[model samples]
Target: MALSNNNSKRATLGLGAIAVAGLVSTPLLAQDAHQLIRDNCVGCHTESGTTAAPSFSRISEQRKSPEGWLMTINRMTHLRGLELTSEDKRALVKVLADRQGLAPEETEGYRYLLEQNTNIIESGINQGLTETCGRCHSEARFALQRRSEDEWKYLVNFHMGQFPSTEFHSMSRDRPWYQIAFNETAVELGQRFPLHSKEWSNWQAAARNDLMGRWRVTGFVPGKGEFAGWMSAAKTAEGRYDVTLTGRYADGAALAGEGKATLYTGYEWRAGLTIDGVKMRQVMAANEQGTALDGRMFLAAEREIGGDMRAVRDQGKTELVAIQPAYLRAGESTELTLIGQNLAGDIDLGDGVVVEKVLSRNADRITLQARAEGAEGVRMARVGTSKQLSALTVYNTLARVEVLPTDAVTRIGGAGGNMPKVRAAYRAVGYSVGADGKPGTEDDLRLGYMPASWSIKPADEVAAHEKDDRYAGSIDASGIFTPGDAGLNPERKRSANNVGRLKVVASVADGDARVEGEGNMLVSVQDFVRRVLD
Candidate 1:
């Protein structure tokens, strides 16, 4: 079977002079032979030659063994009317043998030319297609366009309808022929080509602005299908801002910046990106109220962006500035009654600020109270469902004191009447008459008594005076006696008349126990009690 020319080991002439001689062989230099074949013989016979004649140039790069070269030359010289002497044939054989190897100079030059042309092709293709197409279409567009030659031609034509350019139309017809001629090369080269140019370049230069803050958006008019929205971006910190936006696109994505602010404004803005088209505006006016540009928005359109001159001020609303008692004392609690008007129930007390006390609930209003540990006076930041964020301060101190019982005996007064009674009280030295109705003073009578003069002596003095006869008899020695009426019964009368009016005194440590003086005398409590009983 004949092998295909592409798969065969035959060298191509286009590869240059180095591969040219590797196709055919010649003998050694015994005579000028291979040179003569190129200059004189090749002027006639060639495989690709017409009926006029063929030259050896076409077959110079075709592989030939030494035996094949000799046989062909012999046939050419003898059978085909070519005349070569034996020495000429030997030289021709050597030339053909030299052609079997490669030449370093020719190979290097050929590789250099190939690389240069490849760079030109790549650069031209990128400028026209890849760069232009990427301005509008994402990398994903080219990634999904893997197709056959015919299919790719159709896709190219579709894009030409939108961006009819001279270069785009040229590919519409030639691409298919090129694809079939060199399939692999066509596919690789085709990947670098562009589908649309005008649409992509226009989108590349289009101006845009990034936005942030709270926003509200409305749908486009019916049959319009275009999206429109309102964005409010506020400067948050030093030259930074927060942007919020609400808009819709055919593609599904929410267009909004993060909660914090960024440092940029006006021309120096970051680009607002989305699958759908975007129109952004910076809030030139202050976020506060009553200022000249309180609610105005800076407009961003096509290539230029500016602020709206007509200002719209924010509606005035009351905010809860502060709540009292931001903190509670340790182990201490308080009830905070909701007393302010227009207070929303959805107000949020910050973490650690739990609702512990609720006073009452009614249709018109709600009374609420909360308790928390002091925790070193933590500030309670207030957040509500509405836009009113407020700060309520609560502060407290910790203190403690000792408590005592009310019913202790010591608290009531003087260790309740600890002093002795009159019956147990000490008395001074003295004597008295007995039942025999005679002067019966007993010298040894060791009695607890009071002196007739109502004086008191120490216990030892009274005991010693009672034992002395002189002292005991002194009261009797002064006795001046008179006889009683014979029949009158004077002893009974005297006994009945003598009433011992003893006074009693009692003392207490804290004045709850008392002592009393009768007329001009100090007294004992037992004697007084006895007299009162009598």
Candidate 2:
């Protein structure tokens, strides 16, 4: 597989600029094919470059057929399905055909030496070097390995378990037997150290330093969600790291999960996982804490909830200060009473205004004003004490308090009149009724006073009261408290006078207040007769 160019560790390699420059040349030219092959293909394919498969120099020396080269290109492109574009294929084929494995005619030099290398030999040697000795295994470890070929193969299997995914496996398995034999010798020299001049110190250093700080997950397991974003990992003061990643899940839900992680100084870490839930898996890492992983999701259940923002209370609050009644019927003279709490002196209700401006310094009680439609009634007044309870206040428009003609005189605080005084009372101290039964004014019945329920009756008028007539066994006929009509005297046992004697008994059998004879007596009847005569 092609290496991931977007790997985070690429930054640590310090080869970013060199790699860019190396690949900067335009794809090989079809017309100047020989020059293209000389400039590009020859460097990694000479006898010195290859130890197994024949180099381009050997091919030129042996004079291979053109069909062989064409077959090679077709296998690599169509069969292996490399990503090389058609233009790249054309350019490569043209160059190879023109070169025909020709030897260079350049003068002897280091550049000339590098121009005659082979892909098969170089690829085989690199693979052997990586697998047998070690990519960056400490020299101390390799020096101990003095085993034979069979022993080496066994050891190779062991190391395969340790590093199966690297380039080592490809060169070991993919090539022919001759290539494999070539790799065995290459591996021996690499493991013995000092036996080979090539060194991977820079590569090892890059791998070590690259694995710190933040990284983005670039790939994942099959059926797993896409891993395409960066995540942060920071070392704490205590030398512990906090690794956090934020991305979306397979189901498009937001995902944010974290794990503690540490750096590895070897090959790129292969992300692992432990299944947990739908679209969710635990990360696998080799940190001291646990195995770290990529491509796992942290999803929460869905919800459809809402919030209300209007109910918050205010502790430092002010009282409702003023009120002006709106849209009163014209000439109706409606009344509004204001009871000031923690207010100043009396308030003024302007003329033609039916509202009251009564005020009070006392926070507990307020003097209220009212308005009415009386021919003679005062408008605009203030009624309150001069004490303030904190800073709260009330302002009101006071209309005149008037008595109606149908209103029966009732004793308020043991007093009654057409218009009795009214006032505000603090019931916490005691109970009191207003003189007119209206609240919050001087007419208010003070503490220790009880309002007397009374009704005035004219001399000829009947009193409106429930009479206690248990002993008399009779109710006053004209009294408002009479249980029934004046003609109803149910217990008298009389008959109707309109019918004859026998018929009269039938008519008044179950009824009340019926006359049986001319002399029959009814209290109301007697009273009515007496009044007419008098």
Candidate 3:
């Protein structure tokens, strides 16, 4: 099947440009964007003139979420004979995000869900819709979409046709799903989130802002620590932005970074940078107003540690910026502080969240005692109209514990020939079950990230009998696994000294309740069997 083609077999009502953007390069007047197509992509993709692969232009022609591009890249690599290194994959994906990504204006109300940060969680547009739509996939996946009612109906039809058993799924089987989708869901979805909007038109017509100045950055990096910093970005060429960052982690360690980025559809952002000797990547959304960039910056080496980042202009007027430890247990109360500029007045902690009393307040900071009282899901952390999403989730009890990256990888090192060791930081994600008492169903709630006691053991008891844990590595208090030094042990019967499968386990003791989760990792001798691309 072709990777991407414009409604090759499906009906597509002209919904205007799915993702809007101004051309960044010089106006070539002919074969401009196509030249780019042939330059980078034509090596593999081709137009239907008589080829098996779809044209590169088809990709540029359609609009999609970053997830869509990732799914495509994953498919191409695993199934369609595409080859790439991690860095190469990142570069290609960033290129597509800028070249064929959604406009920030079109994605305004959806930013909360789209942001890849820990301070927030997925929230549905409404209760009923949240259950009907969000139960299966992320709310951002749905929020990033816009369609006519008929087109939305067509989507349901497509799902039914493509996956005939979908209607029989637990979420669907419990209700009149098909009927509701055709009547209530489709109609309401179109009204609540229509494919056409004046918001996009206005933002698209407005003058674009250049991100070529000093920016104040605030964020926390999981595992390593929190940081405050500044950056200066210079646009070197069309769509090319170069950034220099200087910052300090919470522990006062010097942090620095430089990065190259390509702006996608004007607002979609992706970049790679290094800070404080750590190599990382940035996936963010640029606001239409051009005041801020909010997203996640993650370690590039592995799915180890990541956190949220916000970059705003230094001179811009600021209000209550953020809430430290933005969450608390329902019955228990904790002091929540707001960090920002030009702050004042009483703060509204959104629905279900109650601030018992303001402990203190100042121009840039406000400390207050608040209780969640079992108010699960999210409430806007609001100060008037200004608000950040997923302010809090208070639960009566922890429903379930999950090990993020349910699977992981790390290499065993020995001698001077061993490659650099990579560590895995496991975090326990807690959830609260709602009325249904089901872990994954709609009523289930997210408890954000929770502290856990960590341990490591052999995933296989047979491997344990082989003394895998003894030969493997050690897990630290914060869930970091330091693999045993790379080397084959002469005492072992196997020729290889220290290679085996391990289970990283995290446990949390809450009074009489003990919650635990585990993830599997294979301690390999090498980074790759046959390294392909870099």
Candidate 4:
């Protein structure tokens, strides 16, 4: 559906430029930064304390992410008419980010916003903050910053002065909006995210993880399936790495690429790579121990087509990351690939399963032909000292099928418009009911993604009357839903666009039976204003 104009404006103003530039370890010395700040900011912000604007010391009291600092600078440029060259802006952003950025621990739960993950739903938020601030923008927008109690109060007043209609909005009109925001919400935010914290202090003095070696990569892309590979990195400059990724999909398709990565706030990793001719981005964070990098990787053009990535540092230790085609049918033989590092020695596939022949063996990968003899539950696979719990499963019969996302959304676009269509990807998962003999219980054996026939239909009477399934979109055999074109259609009752609420159905063949799974999808209108935050 179309967003309200107020929210659209808020999103446009709140979300600044996408922070994807290659950053340096120290963009500027303290003296150089002071000179640049004086040249660009002292016009409105004086050296000493003033009521008109915050001074440098006062501004430094808060810590934020690189994107957060960029947004603040963009606000100054757009609203306060501050002028700075593109190069100067980048330098200023880098300086501010390094000097006053949030600790890696501070950004723990909010990394999804930085990764631009669209499938998540916000929950467990404070009701007051939801009504006061979340009505216009995501809660992560504010949660990513740290401020003093007075600064939080000042923010509430600033919002009131800037957007006078905020207090009179739908969810605000019935209550004392200003009192709740200024008195209750601001106080809670300040206590929860204090400006001075021990975590930040420790982080400022701690060493950063070195990204200059080989890493084992394992990830699962929603419609494409699982992939495993290796990433090698060499330090090109301070806080920068030249990287290469060599891997393959579960089907043995070659997946290789080269990219440059920038480290921000010590642990935040951002990289741009071209893999198999398609450009992609990686948003990950290095653990404090430098053992692993965990986050999401997506297509640069379409962030929705992405997957969760886990990269373990190759430190001469044996590790089992994943097993391709983790499940096998009982009484059948299948070729299984074990992906990891330093793999060697004896291979175990639990009881009722036999490793008939070894196809290949290597330090990082092992391929073998295995036969399951009526094994009916999860199995732990072991390679020497490395072991993965529930790495494989053998099932005799299919219990049921389930759609990956029980609820999903897509937007129509590209009808002479600037906005591109947002497609939805899905996967059908199978289950075996396990020892519980119940389909949806905890003991139910979990099978991996399965192939299915995809279709769509009206969800309810209202949708049927609108012929939503006929106009909304089409689902391919691979379970990718491509929305219809944008703009008004004369065939509809009120010349409406192709928007609808439909049901997504997946049918999986199981011997003589057809196991079916269903999900709900809303085909909405194109979003006119897009931003990095959302």
Q: After superposition, how far is residue 344 of candidate 4 from its true place, in Å?
A: 1.9
lDDT of 4 by residue, 66-99 (tens): 7787777777887889988877777777777777
Q: Which of 3 and 4 is ahead in lDDT?
A: 4
Candidate 3 overall Cα lDDT vs. reference?
0.62
- Residues forming the 10-long window of minimal summed lDDT in candidate 1: 404-413
How well does candidate 4 match the true structure in TM-score terms?
Answer: 0.87
- TM-score of model 1 relative to the true fold? 0.16
lDDT for each candidate structure: 0.29, 0.27, 0.62, 0.79
- Residue 474 of candidate 4: its Cα lDDT? 91
Enumerate clash totals for all models, in the order shown.
43, 35, 6, 0
Which one wins by lDDT: 1 or 3?
A: 3
Residue 157 of model 4 has an lDDT of 93
Every model: Cα RMSD to truth: 56.5, 45.8, 11.8, 4.9
Q: Can you tell me which runs of candidate 3 are displaced by over 4 Å?
A: 1-209, 212-220, 226-236, 242-260, 287-295, 300-322, 350-367, 372-377, 384-390, 437-442, 509-514, 525-534
Winning candidate number (TM-score): 4
Model 4 spans with C-alpha error above 4 angstroms: 1-21, 24-26, 46-58, 221-223, 329-332, 350-353, 371-379, 387-390, 393-402, 429-437, 441-451, 508-514, 531-534
Which candidate wins on lDDT? 4
Tens digit of per-residue lDDT, candidate 2, span 468-502: 12211221211111112223233432521111110
For candidate 4, the lDDT comes to 0.79
State the displacement of the C-alpha of residue 515, model 1, in Å, after optimal TM-score superposition: 47
